[model samples]
Target: MASLTVQFTLRRYVARAYWTAVVMVSVFGTMAADVLHIGLGVPFAVSTPAFLSVPAAVFMLWYPSERTLSIHSIQTRRREAFRWAAALATFALGTAAGDLTATVG
Candidate 1:
């Protein structure tokens, strides 16, 4: 049916948008973490946990408010916003953690 087709198309668009946001956030987050250390002269020891807590705090708030963190449950604009925020935080945390290990070894 035409309705089914429209729904499918919408879902595809949403998925695309989600993935694009994730990739862009990841790239920018990594750049930010790097800049904090390399450009601002912040030590890895201080920055690693600082970057990590962002995602932790996001999830803490999101989970309590939304009751779930599953991707399949992201059905509303608010949920989508939370998902993007969490994604950005995770990417930044990952970048900082990776850089910290590299610096240590």
Candidate 2:
């Protein structure tokens, strides 16, 4: 029997999709807080979770299925652009959902 070990090296650039996702989530979260405070004329006592985040997660799944979800694997500019766009869309959706919650709930 022979023993084999496989090691993976960290690439200079990782998918970084997680970073974008975090940014988007943070933006939406902040928006939700601000909207609830000012728009509702109330303190941060009650604020709903970002529903838009759902779409963001979905976008990640669909995009990668359509293409690929690797940091070093993304070899095309179009894929990169799509990634950014998905992040932006998720952020925007989160903002809208937050506002809607403030208005309705």
Off by over 4 Å in 2: 1-66, 69-72
Compose the digit string of candidate 2's lDDT tens values, residues 1-105. Answer: 010001012223444544544555567655655665677764333333343455557566756576666556544555544555565455555555556566678
Best by TM-score: 1
For every candidate structure, what is the RMSD over all alpha carbons to the true structure, in angstroms? 6.6, 11.9
Q: Report the lDDT of model 1 for residue 48.
A: 90
TM-score, model 2 to reference: 0.39
Runs in model 1 lying further than 4 Å from the true structure? 1-16
* Cα-based lDDT for every prediction: 0.77, 0.51
Q: Which ten residues in a row have the lowest lDDT in candidate 2?
A: 1-10
